[model samples]
Target: MRKLVIAISMLALAASAAFADPILDRQALMKERGKIVGGISKVVKDEEPFDAAAVLTQLQALQANAEKFDADALFPSGSDTGDTTAAPKIWEDMAGFKAVEDKYLADIKAATAAAPADVDTLKTQFGAIASNCGTCHQTYRVKKG
Candidate 1:
């Protein structure tokens, strides 16, 4: 009985960790993206000195995350609860949502390749990337107060 209890307890813990809420997962991912972009934005806004190398590194990280972002897996069905900002339309119009996601990923890839050398170029390229994010949020993300 003692051994069986321990095995069940371990299994329960593993299952819970393995099935962590998808909403939380996406939220954390978005926060990371936001932090990276925010760092670049500060430089572009002249709030910080423009460092091409730093910008490139941050953009690379964003691109890496974008490349690995799998909405279908991360935004699983019935995960639009908790603190999720995902709208119901995501599950209803999955293809449309995916199209937007694809565009964002493409924009990130382009930005990574461009590696804007100065604030002006960074603004232009990063503007497109930011716009892509806004477009998706407008359609699929619920506003949070």
Candidate 2:
């Protein structure tokens, strides 16, 4: 029984070590951001009624997500390896990478202040932020299958 327990514990430790913590953390943050965007997207798509308050809440969450992201902490050296989709360009031009995130935060701030009262306004705000996301992904992400 003691030997079996030791073997199981060793397996658990190895399994946990298989994925680097930073990659996992960053991936989780991105996934949450996607969900927040999806919630707002439903309103933009007319799949859900335009509730300015609800949209504002989601926008706020997005703002928090942007605020919480620290590029250096999330993308440390050697984090580029493993199963990450982060482009090498991110490491090469960290300033540029940070600029991209800064632009995203600015868009969020602008959108929050505007506080869209209708679908059209929300669409415009969404477009600005979405465009920022697209730009970053294009320059800083690699599509790994």
Candidate 3:
């Protein structure tokens, strides 16, 4: 009976660890970002000189996706991963991580809000958001070894 209990406890712990993986969450976030980008591109291509009204609605949808990409939530308490694209240092350097996250979120928020006036404006705003991806990738993302 004691052996069975130990085995059950170990299984529970392993399941919890699987549920707590940050790498899976990061992958999900990347997938979501791709979906949002696809949606935005579809809108852009369809709306030539750019239908401000339709594009604005699409931008709003993009913002909804952004809400899911919050760094705080991405790196939730107790979440860790051995194979994350995110560096382990992020956990130790909370202030630096938050600063970069704040910059990313703020920039994306503004861009989403400003994206719909015209095609040129949408391009500028989208570029602003893309720049953050590059910035964060350069600083925080670990290349696969």
52-81 per-residue lDDT for model 2 (tens digits): 899999999999999989998899998999
**TM-score for each model:** 0.87, 0.85, 0.66
Off by over 4 Å in 2: 1-20
lDDT of 3 by residue, 99-134 (tens): 776776776678766655767677777777777777
What is the C-alpha lDDT profile of model 1 across 11-127, one tens digit per residue? 999999866868767877888989988998898789999999999999999998887688877898878777777899999999999999898888889988988888999999989
Q: lDDT (0-100) at residue 14 of candidate 1?
A: 97
RMSD of each: 2.5, 3.7, 5.2
Candidate 3: C-alpha lDDT: 0.71
Alpha carbon deviation, residue 77, candidate 1 (Å): 1.2
Clashing pairs in 2: none
Off by over 4 Å in 3: 1-20, 41-49, 76-80
Q: Rank the candidates by lDDT, best first.
A: 2, 1, 3
Best by lDDT: 2
Which window of ten consecutive residues has the lowest lDDT sum in model 2? 16-25
lDDT per model, in order? 0.88, 0.93, 0.71
